[model samples]
Target: RSIHVDSPPSVPSLTTSYVHGTSSVSLLYQTVGQRLDSTVQRWPEREAVVCVQDGIRRTFSQFQQDVDKAAAGLLALGLRPGDRLGVWGPNMYEWILFQFATAKAGIILVSLNTAYQANEVEFALKKVQNATDVAFKSHSLTSLTQS
Candidate 1:
């Protein structure tokens, strides 16, 4: 005797199952000190960074401590997750610190052109309407300004 075969039917759906978007780097730590705890694993006994212009040299362990301090300072200033931080200036050691701190504290960063004049700075500030605090190279000629 021969067996009969049946074909399976296909169905279509309107909604798509998956989508791709910009990738995110996670800096969340279990506690404020956890960031320091994790860095030792990857950068143990390494010269993590040095800033010649500022005469600053720090090993990985030292760098991790500085980051923790900066993160703590930001938290003390009332910054919290989902807050926007705007940084505009020539890249420097402090600039890098602010970037890492913002990420670790879950704040969004908006970079503004340091060359922008007062009028331009106003425009950029308006563009990132949610920015709560601004970090810059010089307090007087900083990149962040309100419109």
Candidate 2:
């Protein structure tokens, strides 16, 4: 009996540089609220967001104003720094508002899927210890908290 084995061929090394075509730009080290405020100050009249389906449009200044109001509302609801706030809803203007509002209010925003089931929602709520859930449609803060 006899056995024979052949050694594997060596792979050719790539001479091309892996870092080619990559570039870096210095990013601003500022909070979301600070960036938004700076942008609003720079471009007050520029359109920031427009939801045609909802017939809603807002300029940078207007959007910042709304964000402030939303932040104030969260504060009035007793949301404080380090508090978790869940935002579960389909894409809408309110979602954007909440995103900025939570950032400004220093509340951690836990985003739940719009298609999440009751169990999934419950799991997320419990996991994050969310103080409040803001759902634009169908669900409300009271309903989520109660469950």
Off by over 4 Å in 1: 1-37, 137-147
TM-score of 1: 0.64
For model 1, residues 24-142, the per-residue Cα lDDT tens digits are 44335475346555777787678777777767677878777666677677777788888887777676777777777677777777777788888987887787686565646463212
Instruction: Looking at model 1, report the run of 10 residues with the lowest lDDT sum.
Output: 138-147
Clashes of each: 0, 0
In Å, residue 63's CA in model 1 sits off its true spot by 1.1
lDDT per residue, candidate 2, 1-147, as tens digits? 332234433554657623222224444799999999999999999999998766778999988888887788788788897899998888777888789889988999999997889999999899877788877874232222221
Each model's lDDT:
0.65, 0.79
lDDT of model 1 at position 43: 79
Q: List TM-score per model, in order.
A: 0.64, 0.76
